[model samples]
Target: MKTVKTHITQLLHAMNMGIFEKEHPIALSLLSAISGESIFFLGPPGVAKSLIARRLKLAFDQSTAFEYLMSRFSTPDEIFGPVSISKLKDEDKYERIIEGYLPSATIVFLDEIWKAGPSIQNSLLTVINEKVYRNGQYTIQLPLKGLIAASNELPAQGEGLEALWDRFLIRYFIGNIEQEFAFDQMIASVNDMEAEIPTGLSITEKQYIDWRTQISQIKIHYTVFELIHSIKRQIEKYNIQKEEVPHSTLYISDRRWKKIVSLLRTSAFLNETDTIRFSDCTLLLHCLWNEIEQIPIIEQMVSSALDECISHYLCGERTLEQKLSSIREDMKSEHSLRETKDPALQIVDTFYHQIERYPVAGNLLIFASDYQSLQKDTQKLFYVQRDKYRPVNWILKVYDHVRNRNISQSAIVSLKKGTRSVFINNQEYPLACNAGYDIAYPQEASLLFEFRFQEVIDLYHNRESE
Candidate 1:
C-alpha cells in the first residue's frame, strides 16, 4: 500500500507542476482510476485535463492508451476502427479492426464526447457501462482499467445523454489557475524535461489485482457506512422536494454508492489503516455534489459531522495535549470577548446608571400622594415603550417594596403571552422585552466536560506513576 501510494503521489506531483490549480481534479481522476470507475472532466479547454489523464496512464507500466477528440461528424470507424477487409472477404463476417482503437487500449480518453453521433454514443455506452465491445459475432471483454471523458459543457436534456453522463460516477471541473504564484511557476517550468515513469515504484498487473482483492476485504467502519447511507436518504428526500421547484438533486445509484465504498477502502489502504476513518469522509463532498452550488453546502455538513466525531474522541481521551489545546482555544475566545464591545452590556450599564440617580431613590414613598408621584415619574423615565409602561412600572414597584419591607424573595421565570414573567411570592412581574433575551454558547458544553477532562488527566497520571 505504501509503495502504491508513493508512486501515485509522485505521478500527481509531476503532473501538477506544469498544471496549475488542478490538484483536486487530478486527485479525483486518480482515485476514480484506482476504483476502476470512469470520471469526466467538465470545463473549458486549456486546463490540462488531457495532461492529467495521460499522467494517470503513465502510472501503470506498458498501459496502452487511445486518445481522441470527438465531434458531430465523427463516426464509429474513427473511434472503434475501420472494417476488417480481409476477414469480411474471406470469412464473410463484419468486424472492426481493433488493433489500435479504443478496444485495444487500457486507458481511454475521449474529448468532446457529447458531440458524438448516435452510433458512437451507443457503442460507447456498451464499452464503458458493460466493459464489452461487440464486433459482428464476437463480444470481446475489454481490458480497460479506466475511461476518462472530457467536454466543454454538460449535454442538453433532450439529447438522450443522461445514461452516459451518469456512468462517469465521478465528475470534476478543470479550471484555469488564477493564483499569481502557481501561474508563474507553471509558466517558468522547463519545457524539455521528459516525464519519468517511476518504473521502480510502479505496480504490475498482478500487484494491481492484489490491491483490488485487498480492498474487497477491507473493513469499512460502521460510522462510515452510516454516514453514506444517510446521505443517500437525503438525496432521495431532496429529489422529492425538487418536484415543485425543478432543481438538480442528488441522483446517485445504489451501484454507485457501493462503488464509492471502494474509493474509501482505497483511501484507508493507502493510509495503512484497517478501517476507514472520519478523514476518509471528506471525499464524499466531492462524490455527493452534482452541481457547483451544492459543493459548499455538502462540504460544510461533512466537515461538521467530522468535527463532531473528533470532539467526541477528544472528550474521551487521556491526552494532556488535547486538553491544553482546548483550554488555550477557550482562553483566546475569552480574551476576544473581553476586548470586544457588547451591545447588551452597554444597555445594562446605561439602564443602571440612569435609574440610580432618581430623586426618589432611598425612599419607599408609602403615602398615597408620594406613591402616585413615584409611579408617574418611574413610568415616564423607565418605560419600555410609549404606550406599554404598566409592566415596567409594576416591576419597579415590586423591587422597591421588596427592598423597603426587607422580605425574602425567590424568582420563578415563566413565559406569559410571549412575554417573560418573573414570579416572586406568587406575584407575577413581566420582565422588560429586551432584558430577557441573551445568547448561549452551547459549544461550551457546561462544566460537565471539565469534570470528565479532569478525571481523564488523573487517570493518566496514576497510570504513568504506576
Candidate 2:
C-alpha cells in the first residue's frame, strides 16, 4: 500500500512540476483517473487546459492515449473510429472498429467537448458513466481509465447538454497563471529552464485493478461521512434561501455522489491511510461545484468543514474575519456612536443570524454571544445614559454548548479531568474550554469570569445531580 501511494504521489509531483499554476487540476485529474471517473476543465482558450490533459498520460508510463478536438460538427465515427464495413455487410450487424478510440485507450482528453453535437455527447455519457460503449449488436466494455474534458465555455440551455455536463464528476475552472507564477514561467521560457520529465513512477493496469478492489474494503472514517452529509444539508439550505445565485440548484446525480465514496477511498489510499483525513475533504471544493461562480462558496464551505474537525483547527478564516473586523471598526467609531441610531444592533444581528444559518460544528464561534450582548447594551446606552447593559457571567454556559457541538468525545473526556491542555507544535491547546484569554479576556468582570469555571461545572453537577 505504501509503495503504491509513494509511486502515485511521485507521479503527481512530477506532473505538477511542469504546470506553472495548475496544482488543483493536476491533482484532481490524477485522483479522478485512479477512481475511474471523468473531470471537466472549464476555462477560456489557451490556458494550458489541453496541455495538462495531454501530460497526464506520463503518470501511467507509456499507456495508450487518445486526444481529439471536438467541434459542433464532430461525429461519433471521428471519435470511435470508422464502422467496420465487413461486419455491417457480412454479419448484417452495425459495429465500429473502436481500435484507437476511447474504448481502447487508458487516458483520453477531449478538447472543446461541449462543442460536440448531440450524437457524440449522448454516446459519451454512457462511455464515461459506465465504461461501456454500445455498438449495434453488443455493448463493449471499455478500458478507459480516465478522461479529461475541456471547454472554452459551459453548455448553453438549448443544447440538451445537461446530462453530459453532469456526468463529469469533477468540474474544475482553470485560467491563466497568477502574476507570480506567470513571471516565473516567463523567466523559465526565456532561459529555456525546464525540469527533467521522469516517468518511471506509475500505477500499472494490474496494480490499478487490485488496488481498486482493495479500496472498497477500506473503512470510511465517520468524520468523512458526517462531512458529506453536512455538505448536502448545507447545499439544500442554500438553495432554499432567498438569495438568487445564478443556477442556484446544484444537481449532483445519485450515480456521481455514490461514486464519490470511491474517490474518497482513493484519496485516503494515496495518503497510505485506512481512515480519511479531514484534509481529504478539501477535494470536495472541486467535486461539488458545477458553476464557475460557486467556486468561492464551495472553497469556503470545504475549508470550514475541515476546520472544526478534531484533527484540524482554524485560527481564523481570512475573508470573514476581515468582514467582521470592518464591522467592528464601524460599530466602535465615535461619529457613529454619537448618532441616534444603533449601528451595532443591525451588525450584530446580521452576524448572529449568519452564525445560526451556517453553524459549523467544532469551530470556535468567532462572533460570541457576548459580542451580541455588548451590542444589545450599546443600544440601551444610546437610548439614555442611565440605561446599562452590563454583560455578566455566561462563559461557562457558552463553553458547555460549544463543547457539546464542537469537541470530539475523546477531547471532552480530557476536559472533565481538568487536563488543561495537550501541547501540539509548542502551542498549548485546551482539551475543552479554551483557557485564560478566551474565557478571561477583557470581559466586564475579568477575574470572576476567569475563575469559577470548574466550580460552576462542579456545583451544577453535584448540588443538583452530580
Candidate 3:
C-alpha cells in the first residue's frame, strides 16, 4: 500500500513539474483518472498542459494513451478514421475497423480541443460520457481509463462549444511565473549539474486493473455529497456573466461533476481508504472553483473552503493538538521571556535600532546571534533578513497596520517559542511551525510578517555549529 501510494505521489509530482511547474493539476488529474473519466486542461499554449497527459501515458501501461491536436480543419474522419473501406463495401457492423483517434486508447489527449469542428467535438462527447464512440451506426466500446484535453479559450461566447466543454470533469489553468522568480529558477536549474530522477517505479497492467477495481468499489459518504452540492450553489449564486465569470464554471458539466466526485472516492481508495472523506470533496471543490473567472478571489475562496473542511472534518481534534504542542514548547521556553528591570521593551528597541545600522545580512546575523530564543529552550533561534527568512509556520502578525504603499515601514510581530500570543481583529492566534505569514500589503516590496520554527533554526544552527 505504501509503495503504491508513493508511486502515485511521485507520478503526480512529476506531472505537476512538467505542467505549470506546480502540483495542483497533477492532483486534479489523478483524481480525475481514478474515476475512469477524462479531464480538461484550460490554459494557454506552452504551459506543458499537454505534457502532463503525455507523462501519464509513460507512467502507466505504454501503447495505451493516444493523442490528437484538434484544429478547425479537423474532420470526423481524422478522428474516427475513414469508415473501414471493406466494412463500407460490405456494410458489415462486425468488421474490425481501425480504431478512431480516441476509442482504442486508454488515455487520450486532445490538444486545442475547442477548435475542433462540431462533428468531431460531438463524436468526443460520446467517448467521454459513455466510454464509447459511434461511427456510421457502428457503436464501439472503449477501454478508456481517462482523457485529458487542452484549450486556450474556456467556455465563453464560442461557436456552440459548451457541449464540447462539458465533457471534461477536471479543468485547470497554467499560468506564467513572475520575471524575477523565473530568472532565479532558470539560473539555479542551469547550475544544478547533479539533478536526478528520484525513483524507477513504473505502473503495470495488473496495477491498472487493481486500481480500477478498488476505485469502483470505493464509497462516498453522504456528507461529502452535501458539501459538493453546497459548492455548486455558491457558483450559481454568483451568476457570473460570460465576461466576468470564472472560466471554471464554463468548462464543467453535470456528468463531469458526478465523475469528479467518483474520482475523489477513487483517490481515497488508492490512498488505501475504503470511504471517501469530506477532505477529498474539498480538494475537488478547490479544483472545480479554479475554473471560475476571477482567479485570485476564486483561489482564496477555494483555500478557505478547503482549510475549513480540513479543520472540521478530516482532523478536527488535530488542530487543537497542534496548538497544544506549541503551548507545551512555549512552557519549556518560559524562561526566555523573562522580566528584566532594565526594561525588555528598551532592549527590544535597541535591538531594532542595531538591526537598521548594518547591511541587511549583518543585521540578520547580529539579531539572530544575540536575542532569538525558543519556547523549549531548544536552542532554536529566529531572525529577519532583507530578502527573506527561512521557511516556518509561525504567524507573524503586523502590529499598527501600515496603510503605506511601502512594506518596509510596516511593523510586524514575529512569533517564537516564548513569544506572547497575538490578536488579529480581537481573536487570539497562535504561531505555527515551519511556515511564514506575509503581512505586507499585496503591493509591498518586502515581507512584513515572517515565521520560522525549530527545523529551520536547526538548519542554520547546524551549519554554524559545523
Query: Tens digit of lDDT per residue, candidate 3, span 1-466?
Result: 4566778777666554423344667666656765666777777787667667766665665547778887889887666666676765786553345464566787888888877877777777788888887655667787777788888876555478766666666667766554677546745664323212344645566877788777778876644654555456556655564547444353346766767767787778767778886556655644454344455655555565555445444442453356446645655764634423111112222222122222223322222212233232333222232423433212121222211112353323243332322232233333221224322222212111111233234334332222
The TM-score of candidate 3 is 0.56
Error of 3 at 310 (Å): 5.9
TM-scores of the models, in the given order? Answer: 0.64, 0.64, 0.56
Residue 14 CA error for candidate 3 (Å)? Answer: 5.9
lDDT of predicted model 1: 0.63
Screening candidate 1 with a backbone cut-off below 3 angstroms (N, C-alpha, C), the clashing residue pairs are none
lDDT of 2 by residue, 1-466 (tens): 3487777767777777756777778888988998889999988987878778766777675588999999878888989988999989999878899888877898999998888888888889889989999887888898888899998888886568888888888888887877886657755774433334464566677888888887777776656765776677677777777257556667667777788777888888877888666767777787787667778878876776665544322221332355455546756766644433112121222222111221123222212222222321121110001102323211112233331354443232111111222222223333223223232223232112212233233323322221
Steric collisions counted per model: 0, 1, 16
Per-residue C-alpha lDDT of model 1 across residues 381-437, encoded as one tens digit per residue: 211111122223212321223112222333211111111222322333332224445
Runs in model 2 deviating more than 4 A are: 181-184, 187-199, 242-246, 311-466
Q: In candidate 1, where is summed lDDT lowest over 10 consecutive residues? A: 363-372
Candidates 2 and 3: which is better by lDDT?
A: 2
How does each model score on lDDT?
0.63, 0.63, 0.54
